[model samples]
Structures are given as structure tokens and as C-alpha cells.
Target chain A: MATQTTDVGQAVGGAAKVGMPQLDFSTFSNQIFWLIITLVVIYFILSRIALPRIGGALADRAGTITNDLAEAEDLKSQALAAEEAYEKALADARAEAQNINVLMRAEIQGQLDEELAKADAQISGRTKEAAAELAEIRNAAKANVKVVAKAVAKEIVAALGGKADAKTVTAAVTERMKG
Target chain B: MATETHGEAEAGLVFHPMDQFQVTPLFGAGPVEWFTITNATLWMGLSILVIFVILVLGARGRALVPTRSQSIAELAYGFIYKMVEDVTGKDGVAYFPYIMTLFMFIVVANFLGLLPMAFTTTSHIAVTAVMAMAVFLAVTVLGFVKNGFGFLSVFWISSAPLILRPILALIEVISYFVRPVSHSIRLAGNMMAGHAVIKVFAAFAPLVLISTGIGLVVTPLSILAITAIYALEVLVSFIQAYVFAILTCVYLRDALHPHH
Candidate 1:
């Protein structure tokens, strides 16, 4: 304080002669003291309080960003897996639909083939019965014609008053029929 | 008083641009006492307060999503941290707070000085010199404490020819000691010159009345020059602070690894 007072007097007396106060030695110590105090206070505040909090905030933000990215990646992979499963399900459904179509076609074809076979069997049975009836009618008519021709021969013989053998006539008629 | 009237009668224009830098005792016209608070002290204190508000109160939320003030605080923190990490490497990280303090104080002081009628504390060599000297002393002490006598190898250029080694060493030693002077002067000089230029241009405003229509042309042009210089000074303010911090980091790097 004593030195400061002496310097204070020198500053006041020399103030008129000084060209630039910055060069004045009397005031430098005071400026230096304040500078030190300011710097020290700022250093403590920055180191102890401000810088650490800012650093923490930065680190926290970084961690959040990293976590969000990881979660997004996980969700993306999950979406891809779900898409793959959906495609698989779609393909299975398509295959099942195709299988059903093929089975229905085959069953319908089997039923159509069975109906055609039943109709053919009934037509063949009708055709065989008509052929058998025609054959029997022809046989009965031939026998009737043979019997009538013999009776007419015997009558003509009697009407001529001649002695004719019935057996011979019958034999002749039988021989003619054979030819 | 008669000389002033005579000077004005003769069309003489008087202006003292440097008078603005005078450090008068804030309370009285008397001599500045050791404990006497001056404009420099007030501005310096304001710089500190601003720093505190921005760094402390601004980041009070510490929210995951930062507010504007929080973002500003984070930006300043990240900017200086990255600069230190890049310039001085991991070894210099320990001194980050000191470097940060210097950068914040200087930048704040410079910007605050731009206010009309406000004093620029950093414009004085007395302020910058102490800061530079502190860095120099701390680095020098750290170098010795860490490297012992081996720190002296910083001056010895082993890569040189044996005959030229002593000459190179002497040059290196001279440059090494010149660090603080150049460091302090660079900031102080830059701030002082810019402010002085603006003041000089402003002084030309009143010369208009004496020079017929010349003042008309000079006044606007002077304002224009002041505007341009003020813009440049704003840039210089930030740059000088960055330069000071980066240079300190470089010096610290040397102290940490003196062999290189």
C-alpha cells in the first residue's frame, strides 16, 4: 500500500507528461492485478462448473444418437424379416390354391369317365336283346312255312284220286328245303 | 483560452485521438490509486460476468436437447476443446481450462470494447503482457518439471551440422525468450491499432465546418471507414483470441515434447 501511494503520486504528477497511458509504468501493476484476478476467477468457473456440464451434455447427446441409430437398425432388420415371412406365407397360400385346383380337376375327370362307362354299358345291353329277338322271329316263321307246304301237298293228292305216299312227299319236301 | 479562440479564428482544427486511451481515476480527476477502480477494471469485471452468465447460467438446463444459450455454451466449449486437441494433442488437454479462460476473456473484452464509450482492457499491453508472461512461466516450469535438464535440448538442434549447431542453438535460444514479448505485443498491438484507427477517422467529422464543402465529403467517408474498420476489428477480435489460444497450445506442445 505504501509503494502504491508513492506510485500514485508519481502517476498524478507525471500524468501530464505521458504520451500514452498504456506505456505509463505507474498503472501497469494495478492492471496486472485485476487481470490476474479476472483470469483466476474465469479459470475456476470454467474448469469447475461450465466445461464439465457442457461436456456431459455433449456426451449424452452422442450416446442418445448412437442408441437411436442402433434401434433403427434393429427395427430395419425386423421389418426385413417380417417381409420375408410374409412372402413365404404368400407363396405357401399360392401353392395350396394350385393344389386344390389340380385335385378338383382330377376328381371331376374321374366322375365324368365313370358316367360315360355306365351309359355305354346300358346301350350295349339294349343292342344285344334286339338282335336275339330278331333271330327267334326268323326261326319261327321258317317252321310255320314248312308245315303249311306239307298240308297243301296232301290235299292235292287226295283230290286227284291217286294212291300217293305221305312219307315220300314229306321226304321230298325236306330234300328241297335242304338245297 | 485566447489561443483556442485564435486557433479557431485561423481555421485550425484540433483533435486528439489518443486521449481516449487515458486512464483517469474513475471517481475523480486525481491520481489513480492502487485500489482505485478504473474503467479498465469495470470492463474486465463485465467480461468476467458475461463469461459466467454464458457459460454457467446459459448451460444451467444441461438438457438433452440444448436451448439457444446451452448450444452457444456447447459450441464455445467444443471449439476450444477441439483446437487444443488438434494443436497440442492429448498431452496438452490438461491445460484446456487455462487456454479456454484466455480465449473467453480476450474475446469478451474485445467485443465489449466495441460498445460506445466502453474501454478495451485487452488494448493495453499491461493486461496482455501478464497473461503471456503467465503462459510462458507456466510452460517453462512445466517443461523443466517434466523433462528435467533434458528440456534444454529444445534449443540444441541435433539435426544441424556439428559446426553450425552452436549458431543454430543460439538463434533458437533467442527466439525462445522472445516468445512472450511477441505473443503479448501481437494481441495488444492489433487491438490498439484498430481502435486507434477508428478514433482517428471519427476525429475527422468536425473538420467539415472549416473546409467549406470538404467536411461534407470527409464526414461520410470517415463514417464509412469507421464502419469498415469496425467490421474488420470484429473479425480481428475473434481471430486474435484464437491466435493467442492456439499459440499458447503450440508453446505448451513444445514444453511437453521439447525434443521435437
Candidate 2:
């Protein structure tokens, strides 16, 4: 077995040195050439193929982040506008309420003034009518008293039976009454 | 004698036929021999082709909801992106392609090496050294392009207190030059050591009957170790690639901003 193994080893070693076909370049040169080739090939693959995809992915990520941020900003602005509108509506409602209050107060005051004026005029007319009725009653009372006094006086004179000339008697009574 | 028996004992073990793949010089070649493709190169090429085809096909549809292939592609992309971002910050996105490619290629190569009867291209010092040199050159060029001569300020310890300037500057320059050597050696040594250990451990399985049984037990253990090491290699591959890329970025940064 040992002899067989040695024989196989020797044969293999011999074949490697002489019997095998050779190539153009030295092992070192071949390695260098292959290394260069590998480098160029790799450089080509990377620059042409892989990098562009990675760059695109990175750009897409950046763009997505930027878009999301912009959208958030837009939404914030819209919210602010909506809030402002809500406040304006509230203020308008308040202003409208105040205006309605002022108008209502003015209307109530005007109606009150109108009623007061009407009452004042009625009171003045009633006072004037009461004064005129009192004056008429006083005049009628004076007239009645004067009629009764005159009739009584005439009856007395007839009962006393004193004869006199009409014109002289009338003149003497009027002069006595004047004195 | 005992040595001969020991040698015989050592020789009784078997390995897969393809395990014989090795880097050997051509017969009658001079010190600088003619260049030729080895099994390692073939495997490396196949691995590269496989990775490229898979990625290309996976990315074909490029749908919104990813297909399975697209998902795999996207996952790889995302993983590398996160890695870059973690290492170099968001600005590293500019370098995403280069870093990702480096990571994928290294990972696939390491994974391929884990297969039985497969060649580990990364185990070769020449291969790893060249890769490290390429990184070094690219970074150096980037530095110059970005900052001109001002990039040399990274090695200038005079930027600190004048008393320690010479020593510190020497140390910095030495460390800087050593980067490529260390980077290459770290990867290549790890791969070579691990695979050699596995081969040696496997060779021990046929010595004694009890040892053979022990070998059977330990063989699976060694396989498990190999798998673990392979996984570790995968991690190291990514880490080394990342380190290379990030250091390049750092060097570039220094070039771009000298005071930093």
C-alpha cells in the first residue's frame, strides 16, 4: 500500500511538471491579468447596474419623506384657516346678537315714548273738560237764584198795597237802591 | 532501519487525485521560466466566471419585489453598503461599488478554495502580493490625485514635536511600506498553513490499524477543522478586503485633507 501510494504521488507530480499542457502567461502574470479583468468587470457591473438602483431607492426614500412633510404642512395650514373661520363665525354671531339687542331696545323705547305721549294728551283734554263743566254749573246756579229773588220781591211789594205813579215810583226806587 | 519504516508508514496514506495540484516549474526551465497556467489559475478563473455570471443573472430582472436571485443580489449589496457605512461613514457611499466588488470577489474565491480537490488561488504569495500592491498603488494614486504632494504629510512626523520627528518619521515610512507585505502575507500564510496542515493530518490516517481508526476519527475532525478554517478564511477575506478599502479611504482622506 505504501509503495502504491508513493507511486501514485510520483506519477501525479511528474505529470504536473511535464505532461500537462501549458498556457501563455506565467502564473503570476495570469493572476495579475485575471485580477485586472475581475476589477474591470466588477467596476462595470457596479457603475452600470447596482449603483443606479441603490441611488434610486435612496432618492425615493428622501422624496417620500419630503412629500409627507409638505403634506403635513399643508394640512396644518388648512386647519389654521378652518379655525380662523370658526372664530370669525362666532364673532359674527356675537355681533349679530348685539345688533338685534340694540334694535330691540330702541324699538321698545320708541313704543314706550309713544304710549306716554298718548296718555299725557288724554290727561290734558280731561282736565280742560272738567274746568268748563264747573264754570257752566256756577253760571246756572247764579241765574236761578236771581229769578227767585226777583219774584219774591215782587210779591212783597203787592202785599204791602202801596199806590204810586209808575214812572216816578220806578225812579224813586232805583235812586233809593243806588243810594 | 527505523527511519525507513517511519518513512514507509508516512507514505501509506492516500489523498484525492486532484489534491496533487501544485505550483511547480516546467522541466529544464531556467531561474526565470516561461509563463504557464496552473490548476490554481484555472480554478481562479472558474470561480471568477461563476461569481460574475451569478451576479449578472441575479440582477437581470431588477424587480420591485425581488425574485430569489434578486434577493441574493440585494442582500449582497445591502451587506456591503452597511459594511462601508460602518467602516467609513455615509460618505463611503461614493466608494460603494469598488468596496462591494472587492468583498464579493474575495469571498467567492475563499469559498471556492474550501471545496474538495479545488485550488486555493489566494494561497499563492504572488497572487496575494499583487493584490496588495494593486491596493497600495490605487491608494497612492488616489492620494496624489486628491491632495498632490500634500498627502506625504501622513508620513511626516515633523508635524509633531521636532525632537522625535526623525525617528517617528522613519517608523511611519517603514510601517507604511510594510503594509503591502503584511497584508499579502497575512492572507496567503493563513490559507497555505491551513491547507498544508489538513493534507499532513490526512496523510497520517494509514500508519497503524489503531492509528488508522484514530485517523478516521481525526480525519473527520480535521475536516471539521478545515471547514471551520474555511469559514474563518471567508471572514478574513472580507475583513482584509474591507481593511484594504477603508485604509485606502483613510489615506485618501489624509490626501484630501492634509492637516488631518
* True lDDT of residue B161, candidate 1: 93
Q: lDDT tens string, model 1, B163-232?
A: 9989999999999999999999999999888988988888776666666456678878988999999999
Q: Give DockQ per model, in order.
A: 0.43, 0.09
Tens-place lDDT digits, model 2, residues B53-154: 656666566565567876676677776777667655666567777766666666677667767777777666776777778767777787787778887887
Error of 1 at B160 (Å): 4.0
Stretches off by above 4 angstroms in model 1 are A1-14, A140-179, B1-12, B158-163
| Weakest 10 consecutive residues of candidate 1 chain B by summed lDDT | B9-18
Question: What does each candidate score in C-alpha RMSD?
Answer: 5.1, 8.5
Clash-forming residue pairs, model 2: A26-B35
Candidates' C-alpha lDDT: 0.86, 0.64
Q: Taking the tens digit of each residue's C-alpha lDDT, what string does model 2 give over A121-150?
A: 999999999989998998887666555545
